[model samples]
Target: MSWIYLDNNATTKMASEVLDAMLPFLQESYGNASSVQHRIGREANQAVALAREQIAQKLHVKESEIFFNSGATEGINTVLRGIAHAYARKGKHIITCQTEHKAVLSTCAQLERTGVEITYLPVNKTGEIALQMLRDSIRPDTILVCIMAANNESGIIHPISAIAEICQEKDVLFFCDATQLVGKQEIDLQRIPIDILTFSAHKFHGPTGVGVLYVRRKRKPIQIPPLISGGQQENGFRGGTLNVAPIVGCGKALIMTNLHPEIEQYRDELEKQIKLQIPEIMIHGEHAQRLSNTSFIAFRHIKAAEIMTALPHIALSSGSACTSGLLDPSHVLKAMAVSDDDAFASVRFSLSKFTTKAEVEETINDLAKAVSRLRSSSPAWQLFKDGLIS
Candidate 1:
């Protein structure tokens, strides 16, 4: 009746337990985690340490491997730049996908200015990367391979285990941008053979401005130099006062998580109902294994902005939240070889554990009505019916 939120991949509502866990640190126990002498500081430090262990347990990694940071953006840059800076003598070459979030693409671009030879692999129409393509891309000069565990826009899960195996064989460091899929999907680093991984707590049901960079150091400690240097924090890999509240919240969120098959059913039913009503629509990444709570849809001959405007009560986006302000077609769609007009016509509907069946049903009904109104008024739709633009 009031508002239906479907743009959860951008961020999720923090779980009640997560919020409850954070309150003590925010109010009464507000001592800085880095302070050494005071009891309050020691308590805060203990909480941070517990949170570190919780996160490590969730990922099947060592507590010492976890380094807290602002969010995935910082985590990604730290891994990318840290590898480049520390291992430049080994290789200046890094590999990633073309459809990566700008946090990665932009960082690689900046690295390019400094003589780094970056290789961006292309994905198929399903938004899935081929394993052999990745193998062929590697060379003796390649030091790092960066790929996402799942795509933020399309929700298509990449073959991370295979990618990591390739990296392990080649002795190249692998960095997985698990920002979109880390919590929703189970990732056991102990079995995957990935060297470095990044994720944000806000992507799950935790507060923003807190994230983890899981560096595999159980075999041999990684030698990445800290990006921010001043005080010795995060084992000197990241400096500055630790965020105790969000870290505790993130830890609580992770401990309270599970696989949601009901959410997947809701997403599928949402698509089925929408397609039955609006027959000409396309569902991107439908064939690939994807996140259960995501649906990226495109109504032929309709602009995504128009649909959002028509359904004001339903929250949505045309692409990743990082680039939602931009008016151009989605770069991820374009990279997957989707047409220019179709790319502009797409909208992303991301759900979460809190998303209910009632909300999804309402969204489906509202979306059909909105699409009908737009398709009737559009000159492009008229041209499409006339077979002028195919």
Candidate 2:
């Protein structure tokens, strides 16, 4: 059986082009990027510089403004630590949404121990934060506002532009976690007044172990304390020897895959087919703008994990990878006011450029079969069959 992968949001298979680009660095040019005395070290440094340039170009920011970290988690930690430590005097209060990744939510939770106050803004039924709620939450002591550009579970795109405008009016620094949005959607930093942005390369078919954080240069002199204190690196914000190979691979992957249009086309076709086959399935974020390559659907009376286990030839997820093992419903869905039944029955299907229409059709057919089988045994369906009064 040919296994189809629909869990692009969890992590993507490393692109062949990305692996090819990193082969030299991994095998031949293995050296510390900070070293200047050896040829290998110089080559690694050069590779790191080039990757920074590529990421900067993508974000429409200066190369100096972009910093490489281990991944989105690390990047987010750095941002939280930096703002909490450097701007502690400015304010001890931060605001974020309840649906943010654990990386962001947990970081804020940790900050609370150090006298930082945090308010988790609520999302609407569509899993989106209202701009007015953000405006209402801003206080004189509000130092920063953090929100994800796209949700990992529902693939819902948040109104970062409107939030940015609100932040600007309040003179509050805004940090956006764009891990799921960076390469999947078009990002123009110039048009959006975001103070900080974070993304991981693996989300875009690049290798893991590399992520980028963009800090707006024009922001008020906010000092961010280092997460890893060491020799001068990442402009002293993050201190550690850079991983040159993965960074090089990440840059190449972004340039190669993100520029291709076929990925978008594939996603459109998948959405169309699934809707045609399963009209009763409720699509999360259907009413709002979302990432083109992602879809979240809940099959009534079918357990998501049951469907996943039954389709062993397919790789898919219920929600975020970080929360995969937990039997509880996704916090994202809960924040969107989704009922327990819908949350447990939802599955996320994310497509990449490599996902073929054949695979999509096969997936749809398999899903229909799985849902039918599960529903036949479901207690809810049995109750409906008994002709119980509505």
Candidate 3:
């Protein structure tokens, strides 16, 4: 069986070079970074410092701005909850989009229980939030505006810079969940003025459980309380014995992937071929600026689960890994106003720099065969063909 992986948005395989970079740190150089007096600890601290600089360089931010954490979930909590507590005296309201990842949405939910007001901005059919609506949502008491740089499911990019401009004018803190956008898109902290950002290493080709939060040090000077308590690590922001291997792997992965060229060509070709082979399938986020490696599709009357179950060789998903197991369709597609039936019919196929054209062609053939076989047996599909379904 030929196995094809098109689920890079969920996670990616760690590159060989990244693994090589981490091996030494995991074994010979293992030491508590907080212990600067010992040589081993000094070397570990140096490795951690280099990782921070590497991540910061990729984002075009200062080294001090990047804080290593567990992953985007913890980063999201650290920023949202941290800000809610830090700025409670000033305001209690926060604004975010409805289609945000569970990390952001759940954190906001927790804040709401504590009397913090949260406004979830809705999106249009194309999964892009309106800049005007965001401006209107701003209140005098709004403490933070949380939005992602790119959506995990559709890969559609939000107007983050525009959002930043709105927050700046309103004097509210802005935090961007850049988990999907970090390696796929270039983020210039010097130009855009984004106050904070979160990204995970596994989204690219790095080890999991390690991520970075980019916080502007000079201009905005965000000084939220530490999310955890222990001896000073991650510059006193996060307190844990550093996972040196994964952090070093993350740095190596970022540096390697940034130099790699765009994978948009393969993605575009896959969607084109899929459309030609399987008629009446709708692809979402076609008009918006999206990540180069994502293609989200909906077969008119065939459920995505049926197609997924029929094809075992290819690796893909119907939505975000966090919500895929739930009974309902993706909240992201629902937020875009896609019908429940159509939402269930949708699937997200994400590519990586390593995806080959041959694999894409094979996936197209498999999808076409699966869709044809399912539609032949589907009474609902037959009714839709006869104009019985609207």
TM-score of each: 0.98, 0.95, 0.97
Per-residue lDDT of model 1, residues 193-214, tens digit only: 9988999999889999999999
Task: Point out where model 3 deviates above 4 Å.
Answer: 259-262
- CA lDDT of every candidate: 0.91, 0.86, 0.90
Q: Who wins the lDDT comparison?
A: 1
Estimate candidate 3's alpha-carbon lDDT, on a 0 to 1 scale.
0.90
Error of 1 at 167 (Å): 0.7
Better of 1 and 3 by lDDT: 1
Show how many residue pairs clash in every candidate, following the order shown.
0, 0, 0
lDDT of 3 at 248: 94
Q: For residues 277-388, what per-residue lDDT tens digits would candidate 3 score against the true structure?
A: 8888889988899988999999989899999999988998999999888998899999999999989999899999889888988898888999999999999999988999
- Winner on TM-score between 2 and 3 is 3
- Model 1 alpha-carbon miss at residue 253, Å: 0.8
Model 1 regions lying over 4 Å from their true place: 218-220
Candidate 2: segments with Cα more than 4 A from true spot: 259-272, 387-390
Worst 10 residues of 1 by lDDT: 218-227
